[model samples]
Target: MSGNTGYAEIATFFRRQIADGTLAPGDSMPTQKQVRQQFGASITTVNRAFQMLKAEGLTAARVGQGTTVAERPRVAATATARLRRISRTGRAYGPKERSVDHQARLLSCADPDVAAELDIELHDEVLVRSRVYMKGNVRTIASFSFINPRGWAAVPESLSPEPLERFWQEDYKERTGRTTVKLPERRGARLAYPYELAMLKVDAPPNAAVPVLVLLNTWHDEDGPLEHWQDVFAPGLWDSDEE
Candidate 1:
């Protein structure tokens, strides 16, 4: 753990175990001391690695239970869960959840893919929001949401620091006198791009190029795409490629 080289060695080792089914959900992880001794990693490094896993929803530590692999959030990949969570709670991270970095903006659509998903012309102004979910020092997820002109025209509070799905709903209806509904989520995943890796601050998995778990979701109405959300989970977080 003298440098970044061995700092993540523990996480990489466990990720392989989890990915290859050598470690199943609920399987207990080695004690930090044991891992440190085994890998010759510093206690600080082990702690950071464990925290990263926990933040990624990969491992959980319970009272008297120690740390164990976490059960996959079978439904979290769906957009409905996210929408409901935001709408009901009016927030992304839990009130008790620590260390979430959030940023928002109303910017021109520069990415062609984003424009296409939002069903808007390229260079149009769109609302873009970025969030980095963090635990300790490691970033666990990088999420970006985009809303097209029609959706933004309603002046939805999509760029607010707080979750405001209700505001979006009310404003959209007040502006257009029409209600909008989110279609079933569309999911896809692939390797993280260079920018994604830089933003997420995670390493590519060993011997693999697919580093991040990507989930695509789009909200729509009678007209066209209203909002498109792209979430990229940090490396070694999501295990499946299911659609």
Candidate 2:
């Protein structure tokens, strides 16, 4: 076979097997060499077929484990659940209040996009707080929050060491007599960056082609934008707009 014919044939063979239960989830796939020999196909054809399987989330290849039928992808909690929990407990996720593990830092707002989002001049200093919600040792969701110092000058010089989402909410209400009414969000997906990969502490799926969910959210009140932040959810680790 030539052109895409060989690729399609090889991919269809595996797809059929998976559907027929011949290749069960968590089962190891034949090695590339074995596939090549069995299909009398080129290495390129075999690789293409494997790529298709991975893109379809039907298989995965690990560094030392070779290719295997992928296990069922984990489903994460909905954003509504997280928000309701935060509203009640002042933390993103944890059995106890104020237990979400997180970090915070002050950084110069150098990125033009961030500056634009915060309506601040380039190079202005902003406080960036990052929260990582975990189910035990397994990380569930990661959030980065950016606050414009000028708009929130009333914030105390020293912020509490705990996760700041609840604190911020309270402070904003106290100062402005307004609650955050809208969280306009944009959602997309892209391959994790180096820093994101390190922070999430997970290897990219199969061929480094699986993209994680990126959610950009801007909090607004009657006045204007209050805060702009981004949340990066690990693959299969979050669902939003759940009905």
Model 2 lDDT per residue over 1-243, tens place? 333448878887776565434576678999988888887888998999999988877789888889988753343334454565455444454231122556767789888988888777898888777766554456655677787774456565324446444556567678767777646568788877666766767876555765789878777667666677777777677553310
In candidate 1, which residue pairs get closer than 3 Å at backbone N, Cα or C atoms, i.e. clash? none
Candidate 1, overall lDDT?
A: 0.67
Tens-digit lDDT track for model 1 on 1-243? 333436566776676465434566778999998887777777888899899878867789988999998766331223454454455445443212233556678888889999888878889898887766554455656778787777766674665766554536568777888777766666566877776777776655555576456777777778878888888877776424211
- Candidate 1 clash figure, as a count: 0
Supply every candidate's count of residue pairs whose N, Cα or C atoms clash at under 3 angstroms. 0, 0
Full-model lDDT, candidate 2: 0.66
The TM-score, computed over Cα atoms with residue i paired to residue i, of candidate 2 is 0.57
Query: Which candidate has the top score in TM-score?
Result: 2
Q: Candidate 1: RMSD over Cα atoms? A: 13.9
